[model samples]
Target: MFRLQFDLDRIIGTLEREGWVVIPNALSATITANLRTACLDMWRQGLFHEAATGRASGQACRAEIRADSVLWLDQVAALPAVQAYNAAMDDIMQAVNRGLYLGLVELESHFAVYPEGAFYKKHLDRFRDDDARTLTTVFYLNEGWPQQAGGQIRLYLDADCREFVDVGPEAGTLVLFLADRFWHEVLPARQQRLSVTGWYRRRRSSMPW
Candidate 1:
């Protein structure tokens, strides 16, 4: 078990100025290795399902819009690797609340596998019916990902969404951004791509059944 240490000042500063940041070596080597193994095991066991778009009643599989498989993370009785990753995320949540005052209450994550030729269309993390999602985080688990692999995440910058940057899915690399502020997409890959994708949400009021 390794202690998680991040440059809080740098992260906050970047978020405040640019609305996003990419951090390399986000996870410790041990944790990253364990998570990669766990993801592979899950993939081999056929635990992942074809990812869908929309929310709740509106959710539907649209392969043309996006093609990938995903397995949502369980909060209770999670595996060791998941627990460690969650703990690290909790630390990040605390720091984010203190720095940005976003009132983030919880995190939800999933293991996503993008097989060769799979890609997701440009979209925002937040849904129309739900505004609780405040921040998006993605940690890559692909080891030795080549520059030519073509699984880069392209993020459109600023309000106009004119400029962009391509981020490779390299192992231990983490990308964080304001959920509604950016429109991003996953480009087609020449090889398999793996990642843990998650979102931090603002607290929601309880609704009566």
Candidate 2:
């Protein structure tokens, strides 16, 4: 079984203090390479669909607002790499919940492929209609990605959006943040980009029914 090799204490501490944390080498090199290969293979097989904006009835494909293709991981959980990734994320969820008491109980994730020039505008992960999503996590799988790639995730540190940080789409890098509190965007890249993006969710206090 694949295992995550990272300093959990430091990571949890940073997240508790900053509300966001970026960790390098969050996954082993072998697992990162495997995930990258899986993403590209799936893309070549035409398993990805154009990603949409909004939620439920409001969702629609708006290229101007965002441009990326995605393959939901729900149906592919048995894949070896995917299972390993899920296991790692579960560990993270448990740690965060133990440390922060966020009540995160589940994870929803997808493989996102950004073709050249693809981008996503600034937005929060939690939907206006549904607030179950409590935390956002993004693990990049682009091997040997460079600073010049331009496919960095710009994370806004404050509500006013003045303070920010741009994180590169580099392999083995994981970004974690409070889902509803942060505004973020994907900067357009000259080449393709690949990552597994997910949200850790809590049970809703009341159902829509």
Candidate 3:
């Protein structure tokens, strides 16, 4: 019942050809609703922290760059919904490693909440000092999000940042892209927005530290 809703072959093929893919209804309605409720409960409990940018010493909360709040999934891993989500991601990780040979070993995810007028400026997923992030995954949990409500993710297709695509923040929609390649950003929403954003990582021989 908690299985992923994506076509494994299609996902692999599209990512290989385009370096990115936006899949609608990537999760079942039951799982989506459970995850959404869990996220909201965490938010209400004040478990989220203001999102930051950069890495390690460079990490700082810069509202100018991003204004979302996040609660790391590990903090709520015991939750049934979170466990189901993790299991589903683990399946994808294995498939990707087998099909694309990305060498991804684990996934780290967080629940992100963007209040009204919140936005994240355009940026790539890989950090300047970190290259472990092999792939980026954004699983949206906003139910009944109308296009007019305005929280769309803008993905830049070319290095010149010209050609692009906009994906609505709809429930069960999942966006995947090569972490170091595409540039993307969240457009300001007229209302609140929610999502589980994560990165698939591979083992590194050495650390910058």
Candidate 4:
């Protein structure tokens, strides 16, 4: 198992104070390279589908609002590189639960590819029908992304959506934040942007059908 190198205390502290944190070099170069290769392979194979909005039954592709393509990472056994990445996330999840007592029981992730001019509009991650998603995590895989690249993620700081922070899509960088608290958008990209996006979800009792 790959050992996690992040500072757990600092991550938790930042989450408590700012509702989000951007960690540079969060993943090792080797892992990042492997992930990039895997993503590209999947893309070449036409495994990615246009991303959609809304929850479970109501989800539908709305290309006008968001144009990225995504392949859901449901089976870790499909790729050794992805499996290692998932293991590392498991460790982080355990640490987060221990520190914040968020009771995050599971994580779901997808490999996302945003082609030139693709973007997602301002929105929160959690859906109104389900409140399971507690935290959102986005790990970028684009190496040496230039400042001129227009695909930075813009995160609004408050309810009024006035002040914000724009994060570049840098390789090995990870962005974490409360799912329901932040309003964020992806700006149009000058080049292709790649990332593994995930969410930590709290367990909820299922209603009898």
Candidate 4 residues 36-147, lDDT tens each?
9999999999989999998778889999999999999884347988988888888889988988899999889999999999999999998776778999999999999999
lDDT per prediction? 0.90, 0.91, 0.93, 0.91
Q: What's each prediction's TM-score?
A: 0.94, 0.96, 0.97, 0.95
Q: Is candidate 2 or candidate 3 better by TM-score?
A: 3
Worst 10 residues of 3 by lDDT: 200-209
Top candidate by TM-score = 3
> What does candidate 3's lDDT look like per residue over 127-190, in tens digits?
7767899899999999999989988999999999999999999999999999999999999989
Can you write out model 1's per-residue Cα lDDT over 8-123, one digit (the tens) per residue?
77898899889999998887988889889999999999899999999899999999989999998883227999989899888888988999899999999999999999999999
Worst 10 residues of 4 by lDDT: 200-209
> Given candidate 4, what's the lDDT at residue 38?
95
List the RMSD of every prediction in angstroms: 2.6, 1.7, 1.5, 2.1
Which pairs of residues clash in candidate 3, taking residues 3 or more apart in a chain or in different chains?
none
Pick the winner on TM-score between candidates 1 and 3.
3
